[model samples]
Target chain A: MDDKLMLMIPGPTPVPERVLQAMAKHPIGHRSADFSAIFAEVTENLKWLHQTKNDLLILAGSGTAAMEAGIINFLSTGDKVLVGTNGKFGERWGKVCAAYNLDVQYITAEWGKPLDPNEFKQALEADTAKDIKAVIITHSETSTGVINDLPTINQYIKAHGALSIVDTVTSLGACSVPIDEWGLDVVASGSQKGYMIPPGLGFVSVSEKAWKAYETANLPKFYFDLGPYRKNAAKNTTPFTPAINLIFALHAALGMMKQEGLETLFARHDRLRSATRAAVKAMGLPLFGPDECASPAVTAVMPTGVEAEKIRSIMRKKFDIALAGGQDSLKGKIFRIGHLGFVTDRDLLTAIAALEATLQELGHTGATPGAGVAAAGEVLNR
Target chain B: MDDKLMLMIPGPTPVPERVLQAMAKHPIGHRSADFSAIFAEVTENLKWLHQTKNDLLILAGSGTAAMEAGIINFLSTGDKVLVGTNGKFGERWGKVCAAYNLDVQYITAEWGKPLDPNEFKQALEADTAKDIKAVIITHSETSTGVINDLPTINQYIKAHGALSIVDTVTSLGACSVPIDEWGLDVVASGSQKGYMIPPGLGFVSVSEKAWKAYETANLPKFYFDLGPYRKNAAKNTTPFTPAINLIFALHAALGMMKQEGLETLFARHDRLRSATRAAVKAMGLPLFGPDECASPAVTAVMPTGVEAEKIRSIMRKKFDIALAGGQDSLKGKIFRIGHLGFVTDRDLLTAIAALEATLQELGHTGATPGAGVAAAGEVLNR
Candidate 1:
């Protein structure tokens, strides 16, 4: 049981053996020509994944680091930016903007609810002076299992001529972002979520409009400075020492992702999301968020009979499947099941069956013992 | 030839098989209690490695990010600081300060020379008004392979009542830093150099004095912010999603380092440094820095008659060994041989013998065929 633990968390998700094997190889010099080839190839494939030809840069840090870089690199002190706050990550962007002395205007929604695009539209329309320099939105809120209407909100930002800084940490690989089609400006994500790799690397895609903002943006930055990254990226290298083994892991994982193709990747996540939602519904447990705004990355469940922490403990200790507990205000009220990255239909079914058993062990009078798996099977088979 | 490549670079020095195996294991959730145990163990071992009981923080970033965090967390805009500039990394710290709009007064030294402690002493003594807030020093200049006199220079900072922010990237594991005895305020390092791991994770050890400074320091930072790191570290966790696999590698590597003991680790590096220098000297290659200030991590050589790049190329193609070329202005004039981390006496002797063969193949008439290895053998055997 020492090595049999399964990861069902949103981040630090399950990685493939091939990816781990690639990462286990001895690291070559980061500055070597061979490393450059890998860098160039990774950069190209990253653009393909994002569905954008924007300048994609990699940094050795977390999603927070990437999102911080996304905001700080394009705005100066007192630059008015609209930040959407519904979940933990959205509020995080607001905090990042505040830390840099940006004037943050918040468009709020209750927890487990998506941000209403009409509010963003009204805000942008009322800003007749166009004081709003950027609109920051988290596409897939990992905390509450809510995916905001990024496309609709981004339309208003484009109409207002403001750059869009998006957090696609949980949405990029799980769903279709289509950066070029959506005209998203600055999109940030991390390796642990949808990249099917371990944490440590952050990816940011910058549009030309965002680069224009960077030209005049004044923030005290060195490590997260985007200019040097862009300059070094032109030569197919990083300005700082990269995590060489992680890059190797990325190279292998991206190769696998490419072989799977984008449609299949997104379709698999869609099926898993539906199956998870359907299975939870059949088990008589309350799903936290509305079905219309469910995230493909994770499902948040607010069960009435079984305690959230108890469910997570049993799932982890007995089933060896690690599920995520709620963060912040939602703690002890909800538990999350991550079906992101390297997860398959079989994994979803296994987790649902375990959950059904956990409910039974907790003495909950559910519909039936096998009903959860049957519901999940209905969606997965479809 | 494919998988037989040997790394002789300062950073990303050869990783141990056990460490790589540990990293290859499945990643667990960072927020899980199991990961918290690993985090606690790694933190304790990091403090032991630094010879300090100060708060040691691990971050998922590169060394530049760690050093930048070390600087930005304790000082505000226009805070006067003296930055030592002798080589690439020293100048890099200065650039970080400049980016943060610090009033930087640099202590002078040539590229391959150690920073003169007297210059710092004189400057600190002359600052009667105590305008200087902190003194930034790089303990080992990786570019020029020169080790600065941190103890002597830090005395001036102490007398001047200014905090010391030190970059111990190359010096931490190669030699004894003894942060507590030295009263160093903020010391930053990376995992790839002396930890016998690949890059991606950075470590920063902060003294109580630096924490007091942090309460008043106002620099806009979110990802590199030390306040949250300290707060989280107290709970045996990180502020952000950590590089879980890299942390596993660090766990394995630091365990090995502890088994070897501090004295043995430093002695091994010292022995390799001496042997590398002797071998380079015997092969008619001019050592770039003086013996008194030689860094135990890497040795730079300015070859005569035989070209520097040519030697590196042949060493790579023929022996499948990689050596670091000089950076910036020193490029094309010198090549560096790294004896840092997992390198042993046999690796040094092997590299020397390969160099002799390379010199002979290049038709250089300066020395006998086996003199280089002979000189290295004497030091290694001693």
Candidate 2:
């Protein structure tokens, strides 16, 4: 293990010192006026980060809780839903929905591939009764480092009259989600990924349609019930005790984001992605995702005949650089290098240089040690 | 809201700088060996903090998630369970169970009251077929600032061949839980409370009996399935991506706890509780819980006819001290002052002084200024 390795994984991404300072503060009373103010600011900031004016509820859980909350609160027993499956998170949505007894129709796509909008349209047309209550899709699938086309998917959901629940756990704060413009009903995100905070808090922004559904929907929930969360969230208090420290971190992270401005943040991510992608290509490695749909948050590299885990382990133990490996079925096929929030061009260069060394150590010929670093530097300079 | 108010809420106590620093450190790769080592340390430390050698799973949610995970994973829908509803957390157990469609039979006690062993026996007698899968109880209810008698309740669950799930959210590190020795089948706790960190992490330690039921029992779960958690927890990894930065805080917090020694930590809480209770009694104000069952974590003071929220607000805005007010049914009746983890005798004294000032500001002439503080000092000094 690299004792001083920097994390370039999708998330728990790098956190700024100020956010950590905010988290380190004493745990305030969740119901107290002080905390209520912090909570309110955080909720508002989360909405701002998503670029939406929807009522956002914070859950003291991982992004999965927000996803589960979106599912359980929207559907009752035997509800049918269409889940776009292309990566781990999308499959997880199906698994979570199945657990709730929801009849989920899986819309499959190959790993590192985007689901066709036409397929979704056909599926919706087939279900003339509109029995499908919600359309679940991931904005940025971290597993394959692919950004799905949400605007097209949401349009399809709109035509079909289904609630659109988008998992922006990796997209928010890293890329443009444009919650309102995209017509997303429910958008879920986590603090650790792009918000530059630790994990443990999940944010869900609910549109008016979803909020109205929350009022009447009953699926047996207390802690994760959206009704209480929505009602209490307006006043800047959670229905239950939140992870107060994380809220503080959120407050700090949002302040940092607000200062940087969303447009600048998006541009920064774009530049970093371009640089990383260029570096990988210069190293003569195959890129996992299509160039058009490649995620700015992370880049997936395919090294022929290489086990993804070994490369990641070597990156960690040798040069103290940590990267993410493929999940489930994609195991040993692709290794991901993240360039999300709090990541810099310098970080990208360091990762490429380390990868070059690790590749050489693994006897992968035809790769110059400095080629990747120089390519990354050129893009970063541009 | 006071800009620099000190929080005296139990569970979300003050965090030390080192813990915050640990949390603020740049994010690490969650899947890498470096993180795995940190994860392993936290898992081992959680076992130590929980005082159990059983299966311990760390979750990225509040104590409620841990509580829900234990119940939903071990009990199938329509299964019956006995819940002890002495305070808020116990009521939450009943609420969450009902949410999951559990046929819950709760032995109720008034808020601020503790459950009697005889009442538990009667509930067990009512379930003659041994149909009760588990008995859910709270070791410390943060709302009412009362500690339940876990030893007595566990004895009942054991005699009846039912698993015992204890919510130690506010009591785990503050007092002696002794999970294995006390016959607790499932023990749930959160980091913000006794672990002396900011919120966002819930932990559960499961015994053999709970695991056995978890294998066959079916309840809706995805983010909080104890099965996957148990399976992955063995390798110092969570089933899902955890609140990684919070784990960093937890590592620091647990390190501090270990340095203090569990015995010393418990004694500190005991001393603080004794001081606060003695001071409250010395002031001649009516206290909420029974004298014997008063939690060392917090002290609920009933200021009859003196509006609780008003005084709490004054305390926050003027004296820069934040205390907890009553919830829904108990609102305006009492205000709770917490003196749990990370709090010192000086902090208790400061809180007492602030309470006196707020009471005076609210025109409460019942108690003398500094009287409680002075009395508290005597107890703490002893």
Question: Worst 10-residue stretch by lDDT in candidate 2 chain B?
Answer: B1-10
List the RMSD of every prediction in angstroms: 0.7, 2.5
Clashes of 1: 0
Q: Which tens-of-lDDT digit does each residue in A135-165 have in candidate 2?
A: 9999899999999988987888999889999
lDDT of candidate 1 over A1-382, digit per residue (tens): 6788988889989999999999999999999999999999999999999999999999999999999999999999999999999999999999999899999999999999999999999999999999999999999999999999999999999999999999999999999999999999999999998999999999999999999999999987889998999999999999999989999999999999999999999999999999999999999999999999999999999999789999999999899999999999999999999999999998999999999999999988967888999999999889
- Every model's TM-score: 0.99, 0.94
With a 3 Å backbone cut-off (N, CA, C), the pairs that clash in candidate 2 are A5-A320, B11-B192, B11-B193
In CAPRI terms, model 2 is classed as medium
Best by lDDT: 1
Give the per-residue lDDT digits (tens) of candidate 2, residues B8-64: 877578888788778777667676666799999988888887778998888888878
Candidate 1 per-residue C-alpha lDDT over B50-135 given as tens digits, one digit per residue, 9 for 90 to 100? 99999999999999899999999999999999999999999999999999999999996999999999999999999999999999
